[model samples]
Target: MNPAVKSLADRIEALLPQTQCTKCGFNGCRPYAEAMASGEAPCNRCPPGGAEGIVRLAAVLGAEPLPLDPERGSEQPRAVARIDESLCIGCTLCIQACPVDAIAGAAKQMHTVIPDWCTGCDLCVAPCPVDCIDMVPVTGERTGWAAWSQAQADAAHARFLARNARLVREREENDARLAAKAAAKLAAVQAEAPENDAERAAQERKRAIIQAAIERARQKQQAAQPRNTENVSAAVQAQIDAAEARRARAGLTRPGSDQNANTDPEEK
Candidate 1:
């Protein structure tokens, strides 16, 4: 950027209300100022600065003052955010959305506004999960710069710059962490890949070892259980032989046996 153009942009930025509200269709007051300095944007887009803001910008840029575009929004009284303590869900959305870090609280805890730090940008209003926030009018009919002082605007601008710096730093840190994690994941996937036949064979051998272990375990279990041989004692075998002989003789007694011992002799 040319030094002349940068100087002109700084002048335009100084004329701004420093709300950093982005009501000018740009990201912030500095962007709108730069756009105006470069002849890309009109000098009357800021609603927070109102008519006086346009005049200040036009003086700096050597252009005629224009009315604030109604499409953007009309100049209104300075307002501050008020949270209904009872209705607050403590979502912390407002805290994250606050460009000035004006809202203070943790998640699941009630948030309160720092009146001195609040820029009244209304950026936090939309992000509230619960309809607990109210934009209360602080300066009744005192609109534009009259409702806001130069000291207040300067302080707000300082806070806005700090907030933007903090956001950039955090984003860079988060991106670095994500990149590291992705690299680690890629390395892990590569490590798990089989580089050659040797690696694949090693894996196969490990599987075989596990399978052999399972088979051995099964055999050991079978060996540990009792098994009946089904062999009868000598006395029991003798009894069986005698029974079979008697059946074969058809109720006839043995040759040396007493007649009284064989009760079925009558049948023979």
Candidate 2:
């Protein structure tokens, strides 16, 4: 490149958004800068740079007014590159796409975005196989534009740390809130649990009493029957006796005995 064009290239680079978004039909800000300096490309080629870029370039080259290139993207408010961690495959496509080397990671490794260096050009969005890259608007406590711009490359780095810290604090607070809610729910359920042991014991005793009454009634009916009918009762008794014998051999219980024994004849 000629020295005059190189000087002009430097001036053009200063006016660019430096996002390397490729809306200007070039690989990065520098490439666009070189093209503009050579007069081969127009000043309106950069959408990220917008009208300001056109004005700056026209001033540098003493050229006439030109409309922005319609093929390039429209100028919208500034935003930054964001990685959708869940969808990101870590292919490093975005890393290669960045003009300022704003993305960091090895091949096949989870990639992180360098927010400070990101120009929000949307260049990295298309290259991602997983489509994990997005351009998200910057939010938080507001600061002056001049302060943000003048801070140089290092300022971008500091902003990144601040953003991360805010996110971590938010997550921690949310986790604590959820944990407290779960603990409170558990405590409430425990408080409502069955508390009266005497009631439960009474129900069990009533069940046993009913069972005994049924057995006694059956025995009484058998005893009242005629001798011919006694054969059926005898067979039933034999089955009961066999079952009892098996239980006794197994040491499960004494034959023909209940743990809550009926001592009185009426009870039996």
Candidate 3:
């Protein structure tokens, strides 16, 4: 913000309740105040401040007092949240949802609210999954500024700013860690270099060994088959047939052909 606008915004911000409830449609009271000072938004949107807040804003800006915009909300008693520990499932949703970080707990652990830091914004109640959180009235019969003091509002605003800074820092750190891990994983994948010359040579040797073994097996199978009858010489086959004919004519058994049958047992 420029010095001129900042001065005006600070003046406007000083009058707000700093609920940071976003009821005014901005993220927090400072943004709402800045918008009002910039003529972008009206001064009566804060229900937490009620009629008095509007009047104060109007007076500082040198404008006519406007009625509190009922569309935002009606000003009433301030509220503080309470946690039913018995019902809490330790989801930590309420802790994450608390704008001021007034609720404290880890994931899967029960949470409790700090009364001193509570802004009565009721932001943390709805996000509780188990319906364990409740907003109870803290200032009954008192409304707006009467319900909350300026010191408390200022303190809440400070805490809100601090919480915002802390969240941003944590998010940035997590992003950096994730990026580094991704880069490391990518490097690891790239490290598996392509096959070297030695590996290629070893593969070639194994292939040659396998092929030689297969050739030997094929040759062995061919050698086991019976010799073809056509491979015998024609002259030799004719001579053998003639010899068999002569033997038959002589009433003699062919050589080496059923010799036991030709010899009688009485001859022994």
Predictions in order: lDDT: 0.70, 0.57, 0.69
Residue 243 of model 2 has an lDDT of 38
Look at candidate 2 and tell me the lDDT of residue 141. 36
Error of 2 at 200 (Å): 99
Per-candidate TM-score against the hidden true structure: 0.67, 0.50, 0.69
**lDDT (Cα) of model 3:** 0.69
lDDT of 2 by residue, 1-268 (tens): 7788877886776666545567788766667888878988888887655666677778887897577878886656667888988887767667655544456665666777767567676778898888788787773432223213533423332322232333344444543444454455445544453559976576566556645554654564345422111122354345434534543464431111211132334334
Largest TM-score belongs to which candidate? 3
Which pairs, if any, clash in model 3? none
TM-score of predicted model 3? 0.69
Off by over 4 Å in 3: 196-268
lDDT of 3 by residue, 173-239 (tens): 5434444544554455445454998866765665565455445444644554321122234543554
The lowest-lDDT stretch of 10 consecutive residues in candidate 1 is 253-262
Q: Order of all candidates by TM-score, from best down to worst?
A: 3, 1, 2
Model 2 residue 208 CA deviation in Å: 99
The top-ranked prediction according to lDDT is 1
Model 2 alpha-carbon miss at residue 37, Å? 2.1
